[model samples]
Target: MNHALAQAVRLAPVVEKVHGAHHPELTRVRELTQALADTTDDARIDGYYAELRAVTDNYTVPEDACEGFTSHYRALQESEQFWQNR
Candidate 1:
């Protein structure tokens, strides 16, 4: 796995703790990241990447977001960059 995806995987539990496991954004992040990681097909990768991009909203950090959330956001952004560059 790539560094960004690895970082996200590491941070996921912490982010869930801070944001709550059921948080929509976190759930989407987990779902999309996992899907991206699990897929090898080019079309599926692109599709998942697009969904992840839309969900992350350029990884804009919310004003009231906690450190965990911000960190996850950065990781997700890096993951996005990794996919885009690939």
Candidate 2:
């Protein structure tokens, strides 16, 4: 529900479109993000964070990442901080 999480929620579709349906990671990320957005319980958000971290591997960004990729990675990191600090 924080700004960074909200931003990542908004950015998911663009990432999915760029990665296409063939990219399983994006699909999983989109699903987990949507789940996070749908819930109000903090416990649920924490659970989602665990799954998201597994998917993102702590939001690690590749050196060769394009702008979109890097933005998406940074967004995840920011969102994670928002969630954890809550």
- The residue pairs found clashing in candidate 2 are none
lDDT of 2: 0.78
Estimate, for each residue in 1-86, the C-alpha lDDT of model 1 and write its tens digit: 78988787778767766776445676777777777778778889778777767776767776767887888778878876787788
Candidate 2 residue-wise lDDT, 26-53, digit = tens: 7888888889888988888888889888
Model 2 deviation from the true structure expressed as Cα RMSD, one decimal place: 1.9
TM-score of each candidate? Answer: 0.78, 0.83
Best by TM-score: 2
- C-alpha root-mean-square deviation, candidate 1: 2.1
Candidate 1, clashing residue pairs?
none
Question: Which portions of model 2 miss their true places by more than 4 Å?
Answer: none
For every candidate, C-alpha RMSD to the true structure in Å: 2.1, 1.9
